[model samples]
Target: MPAKIVVIANQKGGCGKTTIAMQVGGTLGRAGNRVLIVDADPQGTATRWAASAADESSFPAHVAGLAAAGGKVHREIKKYLDSYDYILVDCPPAVDSPVPQSALLIADVALVPIIPSPADLWAATGTRGLIERAGDINTALQARMVVNMLQSNTSMSKEVLEVLEDFGIPLTLAKLHLRTAYRQAAVFGGTVHDLGREAAKAVQEVEALAHEILSLFKNN
Candidate 1:
């Protein structure tokens, strides 16, 4: 069977696209799945994050950077389909970018992470449109909105959730709160899983996202 492609894309920068991709990719990899992360962002954030790992073997998944494949990225990614159980693509933050459009053409699911704010909500419309357009071709494409960097126990966070429902895309039940563990892990390499017992909550958040993502494939 070919790898189930999941494209983590949002046209707005600072929406934690790389963080979510790396965390979810790592979580899935640790589950014994042969996972590969395709960094399609020209900025190469995901590639850099993976490189920073102190021990490459402990990084969980394989990382590849294809910064400028543009429209041909879909074809390029096909080469890895049979080799990996899951392929997660981290796309550039621009709707005008061909990288994301191409990734969507081959994606089983497109996860759009957005920080709670008006601008983030507005930006999601474009990503949603792209996924909808891709579905016209891919037929089975599922696009979901992921609320990222959420502040805990705040009315603002609750308000954001209410507002997200206004957007037409389905929202993922799993969310990622703003936590220091994510940044610390990124700087030193490895994921929350590597943080051990002290970072149990962080581990749970990421694992939840991974489990929710895997369920999509199971249902399909």
Candidate 2:
């Protein structure tokens, strides 16, 4: 079976794209799925996170240079698609960047992680456009966005939640709470699943994401 490809992307910075990628991949890996992470960004954030021993048996991820691939990254990803149960790509901040666009080219699902706010919502418009453009190449691409770092009490968060509900994107029903555990765990090279109490909320959120992604691959 071909592995489901998930590209976590956002053109704007600070939207937690890499964070969501690592967390989602980590969750899937720890759940006994064969997982491969492709660090498409020049920064190699996911590659470093996997290489660090502090994260789950020190998994070393594949790092492919977009410039070197010259539109061949999709073929490369397809070659590895059957080797794992999941192939999650951690894309750069620039949605138009070749690496990210290539990620979309090969992706089965595009998970766009964004903060809950009007500004972030506005940024998603550009992301949607980029994904649509990439869709012209990869017709199998499916896109979904999740709200992250949400503060329950904030008016912005509430307003954004309603707005997104009205906007009708496949929004994750479970949200990631703003917590120090996520930050602390990442610094140690692990994910929310490692934290005991501080991770209670995140665990559910990631689990929900996994369930949602899993639904995409289900066949009648």
Candidate 3:
């Protein structure tokens, strides 16, 4: 079967797109799936994250850079569809970028990560529109909004959550909280699961996200 392609995109930067792509891809890989992370962002943050891993215990998933492919990314990714069980594309953070639209053309799902802030919410409108447009052509393409760096206690977060209910794209049940372990994982070039006991909560969050994402393809 062809791999389930998940394009992680948001027009605004600093929304944790790479973090979500890597963490979710890594968790799925550890769960015995052949996962591949296509780093479509010119920033190459995903490539660097895998490169930073230690030789003894490298990142669970394979990371490939396809930023140069630009609008041809969907064509490029098609070549690997049969080789892996999952392909997660981390798109560049730009509203004008062709990468997100290209990837979404062949994607099984598009996950838009948004920070729980007024600015982030406002910026996400562009992405929501992009997804909506893509869905018109790619009828099988599903979309979900993932709340990242969520500070549940803050009034801003609460308001953002309420607003997201009508944001067009459905929200994911699993949310990632503001935690130091996520940063540590990036530094160490691994998922939160590698952080051991101190990152228990973080591990659960990523795992839950992976589970929810995988469930979307269960009937396929």
User: Which numbered prediction scores highest in lDDT against the true structure?
Assistant: 3
lDDT of 3 by residue, 174-212 (tens): 999999999999999999999999999999999999999
Over 4 Å off, model 3: none
Q: If the candidates were sorted by their lDDT against the true structure, best first, what order would they fall in? A: 3, 1, 2
What lDDT would candidate 2 get against the real structure? 0.75
RMSD of 1: 1.1
What are the RMSD figures for all models against the true structure? 1.1, 2.5, 1.0
TM-score of each: 0.96, 0.88, 0.98
Error of 3 at 207 (Å): 0.3
Candidate 2: worst 10 consecutive residues by lDDT?
Answer: 59-68
Error of 2 at 67 (Å): 7.8
